[model samples]
Target chain A: MIEFKNVTKTFGKTTALDHICLSIPKGKIIGILGPNGSGKSTLLKMVVGLNKANSGSLSIDGKNPSQETRNSISYLPEIDYLYSWMTIQQAADFVKSFYRDWDEAKYKELLSFLELKPSMVIKKISKGMRAKAKLLLSFSRNADLILLDEPLSGIDILTRDRIIETIIKDYRAGDQTILITTHEIREIEGILDEVFFIRNGKVALNGDVETLREEHGASLIEIMKEVYSNENSQW
Target chain B: MKIANGSMLSTLYKKDIMSMKLENIIMLVGILLGHLYFAYKASTGWHPGTIPFTSSTIFSIVLFVILLGTFSSIRREWNNNTIYLIMSLPVGGKTIFLSKLLTILTQLVVFGGLSVLLGILSSLHFLGSDLLVEGLGFISKYQLIQELLKFVTLLFIGVIQIIFVAFFSSIVGSLFKRFSGFITFAIFVISNVIIGRIYTEMLKLFMHLHIESTRQSISSEFFLAQVGLMLVISIIFFFLTSAVYDKKVEL
Candidate 1:
């Protein structure tokens, strides 16, 4: 489980996360729902150790995020972080060489399912293909926690479906934790078991999807619009 | 199944080299052609002085390549957004720092050695059968070999010292995502000036600190003190780099 106890992160004078307190349990897919600049990415990065909070504490599995923690966390950053010079094969081999939990057969299977060749150059690939490759690399690892930041921003609708399907196929049932951040609530609402609605760096609402849906009498998309569309949401 | 740090380093280094493989290939081909041309010229009685690449040119090229490699390797991560990928790995800041340093060091040693080989081959072409038999006073074969060894050693140290400077500068730049170019340049220039002066002043201080009597010559002590200062400073810069990476660098 990843726990954040009054965690606050800031850049210069701009606060990214303000006194965030959360507990993300293992073996569930949690969708972090927020509009742009709502601190979705910051929260995900903090858990993955990409960004650190200025105050308070964050712990993954009852320990602070460290280099060793990365062994069990497979992170897919929001931006395109793959080197342009590497082939699809080389990128896989490179990431595989770093993690002890990398599964080679799974990687090959994902590559085939994604319709990507090992020899395809990353720089020359289309945007959707790149997404597929990134997803494949992220999913190939047998990590306990998977943090995906904006996994479907630039991809087409077809690729989006493929990506979501691949995630469902790859994620271990009730044995792994996946934290995904995306503003596309409608596209992924069906799969998210839990949801976190962040407004002005605060977790305004967080609960199981069924509980939230039953309590609010609205879908995830309507809830996101209502929570974020408020001018007072910018706390 | 667990990839060790050694394997990770090698893979990273290989990735670095693979990115530069095309440029290295072009450079190697050009150098080979130049070597063959000079060899042919030497066979036809062309003098070494007339050749375009003297010892100085060869030395400059090796150093230039090292400088290019150092800057390019560090900046490429940011320019390509690969820093995210590199930092996300299940490795410590020290491992990343060491891999980058090792990549630059490997290029220096390998290319520096190649430059020496080319220099010798060119010299052999000009000297022919009389390559080792020359006994011309101070230019004797033994004297020449000693001087060459000393020169290579000094050059190696110089390269390493500058690498530490560049490595530390790069880490300092990594601390800021915006205006990092200006920051890196400012740090490099400012620190270079400050450190250069400090080294000179410290050498004199160390010299005076070690010598209490009039008979203890200053020349050898000065040389040793200078080398010692460079090494100590290099290590300090290396540690500073690792510290900044661990404690300060955001991503």
Candidate 2:
């Protein structure tokens, strides 16, 4: 489980993440939904030790996300972070050398699923293909926690569906936790067990998806639209 | 299967070397060939120079290649975001830094050794058929061996200094969000200028004091000892950089 306690992160004078306190348990798919500049990415980065909160503590399984904590967590940044000059095989080998739980067979299977040639340099691939390759590398690691920021932002509908299905099929349950941040909530609503709607720098709304739907007679997307629309109506 | 915890440093070092491309090898070879050609031309009367100067120039060229290659390796990794992957491993930042240092050191030694071997071959050719007799006449075999050892030691010291500068620059580059390369270069230049000024001032003071005996006492062994101390200081600075990197907030 990952917990953020009174976490407040600021950049210059603007607050990127307000005093946020939340506990995410193990074995669930959580979605972080927000529009641009909503601090969704900052929150995720904080959990992975990429960003330090200005005045609070974040812990993964009761431990701060130090180098030791990072060993158990796999993170996919929102950009193309792979080395451009490396062939897929070389990248895989490089990653495998560092990770103890690297599943070579699973990595190979993911490559075939994504239709990526092992010998091809990453810079030569299209954007969508590169995204798939990144996903393959992150997923093949048998980490206890996976944090993916904006995983489905640039892909088409068909490719997005494929990625979603791949995540669901390959994800190791009970022993692993997945936190994904994306704008496309409806596409992943079926797999998301919990949802957090962030506005400005705070959690505007958060609850179990099924419970919220049953109580409010509305889907997660409808609630988000209503809340955001009403907030914008005053302007 | 997992890589054993104890051997992780060696594993990472080996992988770093394997990741080098054919292009990098070709560039190293090109530099070596260029230096060798210059040495041959100077030694064979195509250019004018005393034997010691020619040898020293050849040695300096090799040293320059080693420094360039080491710095370029780190720069390539930084440009490609390979450092992110490297830093995310279970290994400590110190281990990763040390592995890279060792890798660069090994490459420098190998390249430097090859250049020395080429220099010896060229010298033999230039000295003609009485190669053994001429070498014996110039210096005793034991003294020649000692000089060769000193040369190797000096080359190693120079390589260590370059590594220190390169690693320091990389840390500076990674610290900021914008114009990192420019900022790192500026820091390097300013620091070097300050050090140079201090060194010059000390030399002037020594000359003014008429310390002839002090100047005469400085030998190759003394120089090597000073360089060894500098290498230790470099390692400490590298450790500080790694600590900051491990805790830095990446955007």
Candidate 3:
């Protein structure tokens, strides 16, 4: 489980996460649905301890994210993480060596399923291949919590379906809680047990997807659109 | 003492070495060639009296390599967005900073040793022709080693200072998301100029105050003091870098 208590992050003039608070539980696929600059990535980065909060506290399993927390959490940033000089194999091996829970068999399966060549350099890879590479890295580790920050961005529809399927397949294995952020909502809603709509550095809507759908009579995407449109000062 | 994960540090160190393999090779090879050329020229009567490249050549090359390595190791990570992967690793700021600092330091040692070795061989080459300290008595091996050691050790301290300066600049650049390249340039150039001026002025004041009775030279204690000053400043800058690194924004 993860908790953010009045966490705040700021840039020069803009507050990325302004006194925001969030609690994310385990063993479910949670979609942090928001448009760009909605503190989606900032929230995830805080959970990984990549970004320090300006004020307040953030902890997972009652402990702040640190070197030990890194062992339990896996992150996939939307940006290209593979070193430009590395071959796909080198990058995979480098990542795989760090985790004790790394499953080589699963990694091999994902490599084959993802259709990524070992000899391919990361900088030379296509956009879709790069996406798959990021996905492969994130899914290979049997971490307790996996944070995928817009893993579905900048991809074709088919690739998106493949990514969604890969995530769904991995989530079904259990004991793995994934928190992903994305603006593209229609594809991820069916898979999300819960959704957190963040806008202007605050959580606008936070609840179970099914209950919200039943109560509001609208899909997550529709609600997301509504959340952003009227999210002026409060959410 | 704060514990550091050794294996993770090695992984980070290895990645930097792999990324910097070509530059490392070039620098290593350059040292050999520079020494051989300097030695070969001095052996013959082609150059009348003065050695073409002395300590200044070594200093120039060493400083250039430090700058290039620092840029590739630190600034390149920020530019390439690989800092995310680096920062997210199961390690603390101390681990990241020390691993990188050690990697560059180790490279400096290797290259620094090569420079020293080359200087020694050039001395011997000149000695073989009886051109070294020509007007003075034959220079003993012990005296030669001491001289080279003094020069190299002083230069080593200088190289460390330059490395830390570039590192601090890289840390500053990471604070900004946009135009980080510009910030890095300004930090590296401007900070170096300001620090260099201050260092020279301080050194001049010290040398002026402590002039030996002969007026020919100051004591070895002066060089020791200078080395001590340089090291203290380098360590302070390193800690500053690590402190910023610990709470750095993942921009």
TM-scores of all models? 0.89, 0.84, 0.83
Clash number for model 1?
0
Q: Largest DockQ belongs to which candidate?
A: 1
Model 2 lDDT tens row, B1-251: 34666577877787666656553486468657755676667756764334445655766776666566565666666677766566556667677777778877776566666666666666666655487577776667445665666666665665565576676766777677688778767766775666457556655665576643232244454445456655665676677667766776365
Candidate number with the higher lDDT (2 or 3): 3
Determine which window of 10 residues in candidate 3 chain B has minimal summed lDDT: B210-219
DockQ order of candidates, top first: 1, 2, 3
- Candidate maximizing TM-score: 1
Residue lDDT tens for model 1, B59-83: 5766787686677778888778888
Tens digits of per-residue lDDT, candidate 1, A1-235, equal 8899999999888888999898888899999988778888999888777788899999988888877788888899878899888998889989988998988889889988889999999999998998898888999889888998989988999999889899999778799998999887777888899989887888988899988899899998888777766664432
Candidates arranged by TM-score, highest first: 1, 2, 3
Clashing pairs in 3: none
RMSD of 2: 4.1
- Each candidate's DockQ: 0.70, 0.49, 0.45
Tens-place lDDT digits, model 3, residues A8-30: 89877889998898999888899
Greater lDDT among 1 and 2 belongs to: 1
